[model samples]
Target: MDDGKLARMRQWMLTEIAVETACVREQIGKAQLDPQVMDVMGEVPRHVFVPAAFQAEAYLNQPVPIGCGKTISQPFIVALMTDLLDIHSTDSVLEIGTGLGYQTAVLSRLARQVYSVERLAGLAREARQRLDSLGYANIQTRVGDGYLGWPEHAPFDRIMVTAAPPQLPPALLDQLRNGGRMVLPVGPHDHQALMLVRKDAQGQSSTRVVLPVRFSALEEGEAADLF
Candidate 1:
């Protein structure tokens, strides 16, 4: 409703996320998320990223469906994922799932540029329009198979995949520059875990399971050729 009320709700949501992080500190390896990540999370209006019918639930810490059989990630997961990337202001990020542009908007705030790939045409169009309407100039979105990653902008400084792939895609690893990091969910449909992959200067990579998670499967189709 009112901007003031929404701001209050947003802060409350951030507080809840902090408490949740503390509850799982042993597994997540941190009692609190990055301060910049928290600030960006608080600034982004998640309500605008979901359908009007679900705006009332936007401030909650849970995921809200955004149609196309997808849901904007839960607030805590968004904060945690963003925190894990450790995005720098000069970094170029490749986001594998655009959903409704909520996470894209967050990335635009933290990085210099963000190339997002969405599998659903409708979702891609809407997410692009929404981000444009919000004046997110540093973000670019294309409808395609996120599994393929965005080759045109290869060797990204950071990558964030919101969908779960049964296994890591070789293209993504190849697209990450040395000393870069990527965060994503990997595993089968019934079982998935959030994974962090780091590429060293020598081009060697290492992975660690951050925590258990569930996300829509990464889709692949001929439409990946679409710009």
Candidate 2:
């Protein structure tokens, strides 16, 4: 599709996201998402992040499959999660699941640097290439177990996990800097809730459920092949 058409579709998607946000305002505690998050959501070309066969569904306010049984998160969830993080221009963010780098792309526009970890080497490689081609120079990606939380770059100002874990991963909590925030889906594959976790200056953490959601399970242990 042409850029004009894609832009129009993206506008529709944004409208849908706004409407969805309003529908769940009570749970999320806000009627609208952060304007900055919406702006970055609008700027990122989601079509470029999905498989060629699914690009036409890129701006539908839904998740598009990116192979390996993983689906890029729904646009509303992406915006909500990113908004929950309250990312700052000077902050360093760590993303746990880099499926095609859609969320990473969004985070990259808001944070100074993004450290992303993907469990599948193939997906990590493709995501890295796509981000590079799009001129997102501040992102560094590595294929590793997302549960490990990139220890080399621990103590991140913010963290976002795309996949759902049965519970909060301990390493992720340790990596979050004091006063940092994290958003992710927590629960079994069939039943999950989008959760926002906040760590205070004293490193005590509190969590709240933002809304209901379903995401692929966060794989554990060694990296694997996407195919």
Candidate 3:
């Protein structure tokens, strides 16, 4: 993990996106964006979060396998969904699917605290260690069924689901505080749409599709252990 090398890669990646060579701009054209999201994206070391075998492609604006049949979402999608949250500095976020902890790191930079869940025990443990090693202290992770949501930390100010579910999970919606926002991909294997969910101040919620997306389906089951 060479810090300098990661810094270089991140810079190159941002440049690629800014120059439109990676189609990040085309993919998210004129969408609402928060400069802070871009700052976080620029700061996080994506290569270190990716599996070593895929490190070279870490900054390519594409998904790469990390294991357990999961792949981190492409950088543009991550940035788009994160910006859609409109995260506040004081907001607390619950993230479904920790994956490689890259998004967790980004969320930690914007939110007061982040609670992330992963179905696979190995990925959970590895992500926890990687995040901790990278100095992300605001992230809490657990290995379990994300559909159930983390009831102990209920009423989060925001929620983000990395995996696509056939339908919205009621528990996750319940866990979101009034006025909270959630971003996730919904639908089937062949096609899915990134959905933005907003819980109004009156406690009613609304959802709308933001963009077409593809993601591994969310799973259910008790993990082997926290490891």
What is the lDDT of every predicted structure here? 0.92, 0.93, 0.86
Residues 103-148 of candidate 2 have per-residue lDDT tens digits of 9999999999999999999899899889999999999999999999
Model 2 scores a TM of 0.98
Q: Which has the greatest lDDT?
A: 2
Clashes of each: 0, 0, 0
The 10-residue segment of model 2 with minimum total lDDT is 218-227
TM-score, prediction 3: 0.91
Which tens-of-lDDT digit does each residue in 1-227 have in candidate 1?
A: 99999999999999999999999999999999999999999998899999999999998999999886789999999999999999999999999989889999999999999999988878888888888888999998988888789999898999999999899999999999999999999999889999999999999999999999999998866553232
Order the candidate numbers by TM-score, best to worst.
2, 1, 3
**Candidate 2, pairs of clashing residues:** none
TM-score of each: 0.97, 0.98, 0.91
